[model samples]
Target chain A: MKAFQSVAVIGLGSMGLGMARSLMRGGHEVRGCDLARDALEKLAAAGGSAFNTPAAAAHDADVVVVVVVNAAQTRAVLFGPDGAAEAMKPGSVIISSATMSPVEAQEFAARAGEHGVLYLDAPISGGSARADAGELTVMASGSPEAFSAAQPALDAMAQTVYSLGEDVGVGSSFKIVNQLLAGVHIAAACEAITFAKRLGLDISKVFEVISKSAGNSWMFENRIPHVLEGDYAPHSAVAIFTKDLGIVSELGRKQSFPLPVASAALQLFLMTEAAGMGQDDDSSVARLLAQIAGLELPGMERSN
Target chain B: MKAFQSVAVIGLGSMGLGMARSLMRGGHEVRGCDLARDALEKLAAAGGSAFNTPAAAAHDADVVVVVVVNAAQTRAVLFGPDGAAEAMKPGSVIISSATMSPVEAQEFAARAGEHGVLYLDAPISGGSARADAGELTVMASGSPEAFSAAQPALDAMAQTVYSLGEDVGVGSSFKIVNQLLAGVHIAAACEAITFAKRLGLDISKVFEVISKSAGNSWMFENRIPHVLEGDYAPHSAVAIFTKDLGIVSELGRKQSFPLPVASAALQLFLMTEAAGMGQDDDSSVARLLAQIAGLELPGMERSN
Candidate 1:
């Protein structure tokens, strides 16, 4: 394993924190940063140094992983006030693991290049559970040097890192494609289950049958349990897809590609958000659909 | 096994022919009927007797398995001129395996009862390959007597027979739910693949990553190979989803439930049908999408 002696993980959210711990477990000297004090403290207690800002954590690191929310946050973390780019050593790798448009990724990579830093446009999949298990799948694209530089952290955090090619934005493009399908599938799963509920079929039975049938998706298998158990505790929240699919819609518009199915799915996520369940598990879109149809879902009471 | 000595199968389509052969292999005196002479001759060559009409084939049969396309054809096969219902024994079972509304299943069951016959609302999954292998899944609902009478053929035809309940419509309800999801997932797969193409990512590479990642569906796994191979030969035609999702749309409208995602999927199938690829594989919807987006899918010649 190509092992970086010192690695900095900026943004200690669920995915970031898990990744940071995984890197530490892989025997790297890890530094973590996040605005959330609890997240910072948790990593600190786990035998890694914690910093309040990205730059301070990244200052002496051999490799920095930016696992922030989106392109804007990724940019802010690297180029904002007290940003990591200036503090990082020349030739250090920046592994950007945010879901963003290809254009943004390319721009970010070019900016990082200007700072004499190699950038790997890497976007991650698998939920935080996989991240905690150190088995996340990464879609990555960059120069050979960037991949070689990021190898240590990538090996520590990912079970599979798709070496997409030499283009800076290809990873982002792949991730966007994945988000389009994933978001559509989640909404479709919610729609199917609620539609089953509306049809008076046993929702659990529908889940069981569909899981074994041609109807099933990875999202359906993973997310339908939340609907079945009436547990909307967000493993992946409604707002996450709302944001992701919004990116899809924006990209589609720019490309003159009409994504009608994705467009429809986005509307459902938007409706879920509009119903104030944006922070809830995405399966709560089932609840919203049920509400609109005047159908009662298992763990939901009728407000009227 | 509650083994019936004799069985009759109506509508020798791909699914019906496979199921009929499976019953024959199960040691039943299987009789088959179809309007298509080629289908009937194929069954006849396989050692099952073939008849010109449903009644002649069903005459004196202990179980009549109706495996037609939809509710209307199901109704016509059982009760139309020279129908099977009038010719079957009084206590014989009628297994309706078409995808239909719960109301239609119930009405058919009631009519069968009036004819002094038993009815099993058994809708099948697992497609023609499984049907040929006699390993299909059957979502079945009927009286104990009806189940007992149909057991031999069911045992031959299905690996998993989900006994939904005593109610005649329950199996149809489950089936409708499955079709709703299956149709939507297929359309979602097409949309995602085409969207990937629009983004200039290698389609096969996108398929590889997404299949291992979260965006995958059973349909995606099964059907995308057809797209990747540039083979649009109809394993399941675009018209099938057009018809099945039409059922979904009609059911949604009748129940006043908005199946927005399903409606979106239905429109895509409708467009595929409108583009005259109705007889091609359902994945041709991806080709249609590519054409619309001015993208070239593998094996698709530009029409302009």
Candidate 2:
């Protein structure tokens, strides 16, 4: 692989910014654009070129990585005001890393193809920590040409890149499936911790036992500390699950399948969001449950 | 703890038989009873006395460890014809190892007190293998005397013994809390695997990606292999969750707290059971979901 290639990272949010730095660390000449002035300034401070529009950042780049929020935002970055797709050189690859439905991924692939640009459906996992370390897991699929084109950037951004055949949309399907379990597990962790508190258990003891026991999940071990410490900071916000599980609910209904566990979890996130904690960490549902149950959870004695 | 004490094991099923042998390995004089003559003979072969009834088994025992099925069976062995509680000497302890409601445990503790016996509300976790190795985790509570009397037996049967307090019901409450998470995780794992199948991805690949991803759970890592290999053998049966989650539902309603995720998991177990897999491994819910979606799961081409 070439030690250096021009790469455009179209968003510099938590995940995208870490990925931008990771790309630079991997010796890629990185340029990025974001609506947030601070984010663009941060990328510039990290010695990468920063721009206000996707077109300007992606201009003359070998690869354009769209790390925006959903299908619509990804679409916007590729085709909207001063979008990257029309400006990206022919044969250049567009690596889309949004958590969108397979159908949306397929649509974007076709549109990118029409612009004579190769499109790789690449959905990433691992939160900001992994993203910063260049250790995210990438679920990706596209033409072999696209794979070859995206190889250097993919190597820079991911610890694991699954080449899921030459079909588009498959990577998104895998991502949505992952989001389904991730969402449900998060809600279950919230439910379990609050339920433990209601039982008059030392909630911290519950965490220790469950961490070693069969009840444990990545979410349970990773997210329950927020509840124990009474911290509601958005390590990952409750609104993220609302969006992801909404994608799952939408996709499941499209297939005529029921997602009882995930849907129940969605209700919890939705309920928490409605209760005004959508911006808080997803573990805030535990607080919501505790508040409703008239139980005082740790770190919650002072709060309403 | 004493190296030698007369102990009666009231059940000799998978978990019970292992506990009995573990106690014997700890140098206890173990006497046990079970309806299975093979179990009784196995104990005899191990040089422990195996009687036909609880009373005969409990005769002159210093500790009577009741490892029966539920609250009712525990009551049957302790109070019904040829009951162990009456047969046990006064001041001896009874360690109850059934998954029952806290209220039932409290009631049993009260009744055992009437028989001049100290009752320990001790519910065991970790499966038969752990039991056989004397490495089970015991969530236990009772009086100070009950803990002191049960210590030798507990040391024999468990690697980790949690003295939840002097209250008889707290141990059961902790166990129930553990069950709530365990059941929901199992169901979510099943849902994820089936959803992956519907997405037309390699199901084993889903396992590989998810094992390292945030979607992972103890149940997912432990149970998804059964689905991949298409083996439905009961490592832990589906009926167990139906029963355990039933207890959770019962207790949650009693506390007036909604258990939506656990309740969803209970419905999946119930649906799988109704489809005739109650005795199969809890992961059998994955097969049920595949069957509904008309997808062929591994090792399932031969079955209806």
Candidate 3:
């Protein structure tokens, strides 16, 4: 494989830090950038270069993986003031891994094309732990050239890379579609867990039964354990869904399509954010439901 | 294995037929009854007894499996005009597998207790295919005597039986809770598949990606193939969720709970029914979304 030895990963939060480490593990020369000094310093301590600005990291990088928070930050990292797009070589590729709208991804790809740089609409999943293990799932779409150029870094990072298609927005569209299901499943999991708790069934037993039954989801099996343990650590925060579901609702609105399930789930996520649990783990959504139901879960008191 | 020498399955729908055959295969003398003469005759030809009414089948049966549509039918079969509750022997066990509200299930159990007959609040899942293979999952709750009485039928019909508790309503409550999640997941699956199709991506490819990603759902993997094949054969019909989600919404309303996801899913199923696809497979809810989004699915000529 034609490997991209110099890789830049923007936004050195939990997910970005893991991707940077994975790239280094894959024998790539990696530069990580973030706004937080401590996060950058930690990356530097882990045998990688750390930069305060995106341009500093993107310079001479063959592949850039943008893992920022949203469309605004992703745009800022790529084409904002002293943006990385202007500094990258003509043949270099940008693998955008943020959960953004299809329109924004399409715009980013178009502008990147103007600079003669390939753009892959790649949105990362499997959370921070998978990112750290270089085992994230990448829902990706781009030209054959872009896939070829990004293959080394992609191989270094993702265990499952879905080649959505050649259309720029299609990959982001799939990601948005995916977020709709993921976000809804998490809230549904919250409702089911709290409902079982309220019904006086054993919460852990309910989890075990439902996980084996048809009621299970990837989110339920993953998130309900956090609720059961009463751990609110931010593996993936409630704020992330606040952003992802907002993108889903916005895209549905733009298309004049009514997404009641996604809309209801967005409202629940909004309530979670409104209740001041935005930074808590997304499983904190169960806490919101428990608070509403006036019930207590195992290993935890009532949310109120 | 108390050995159900003579068993009567009171409904011969998709679930009941498979269950009766499984019981017959388990060396039970199976008697199947249904209002439909054709269904009863079909079972009779398969080397089991068939009756036009419940009275003829329940007179001397040791075990009775009631797999009717919902709570009302279960009530009608047990207590309505010409009901079989009066005809069954004092010690015979009645296994009620209808998806009902906890309050209703409790009332039925109490009423069955008055008849000196054992009642098991047993709700089965895993569709007809599993039922045919005797590999269905049963969510059961009842007294020890009721469990002991129902064991022959349960063992013959289910590969996994979750003994929720020894209370009558607990099994039904768990099933309702399961329905809440199952209904929401099926609706979410339809929404995701429709959203992906509208974005001009291949439906099969999206299914492939989402199944491997965090977005994967039990319902999505189980039901999307019906949509891809353009086969609306009623594995589970739209009207099934129309009733199940309706029951869920009713429970939420009565309990004053905010079940937005379940309620929204109920509304969508109602819409799917109103579109005259009530008897079609529940996966055809994807066509409802496709109609709204103005996208054509494979094997369907028009977007609508």
Worst 10 residues of 2 chain A by lDDT: A295-304
Interface RMSD for every prediction, one decimal? 0.9, 1.0, 1.0
Q: Residue-wise lDDT of candidate 1 within A1-304, one digit each (tens)?
A: 2455699999988899999889989999999889999999999998899988889999978899999889999999999998999888988999999899999999998998888999999999988999988999999999999999999889999999999999999999999988988998899899888888888888888888889887889999999999888899989899999999999999999998888889999999999999999999999989899888888877888888
Q: What TM value does model 2 have?
A: 0.97
The best-first sequence of candidates by DockQ reads 1, 3, 2
Local accuracy of candidate 1 as per-residue lDDT tens digits, B1-304: 3465789999999999999889988888989999999999999998999998899999999999999999999999999999999998899999999998889999999999998999999999988999999999999999999998889889999999998889998898888888888888888889889888888899899889999989888888888899999999999899989998998889889988888888999999999999999999999989988988888888988878
lDDT of 1: 0.91
Residue pairs in collision within model 1: none
Q: Per-prediction DockQ, in order?
A: 0.83, 0.77, 0.78
Query: What shift in Å separates residue A271 of candidate 2 from its native position after superposition?
Result: 0.4
Ranking by lDDT: 2, 1, 3
How many pairs in model 3 have backbone atoms within 3 A of each other, for residues 3 or more apart or on separate chains, i.e. clashes?
A: 0
Tens-place lDDT per residue, model 3, A1-304, is 4564799988888899999999999999999888899998989999889887888899999998999999999999999987889888889999998989888999999999998999999998888889899999899999999999999999999898988778888888888888999999999999878877777778888888899989889999999999989999898899999999999998888877789999999999999999999999998888988887787765556434
For model 3, what is the error of residue A267's alpha carbon versus the real structure, in angstroms, after optimal superposition? 0.2
**Candidate 3 chain A, which ten residues in sequence have the lowest lDDT sum?**
A295-304
- Candidate 3 Cα outliers beyond 4 Å, as residue runs: A1-4, A302-304
Instruction: List pairs with backbone clashes in candidate 3.
Output: none
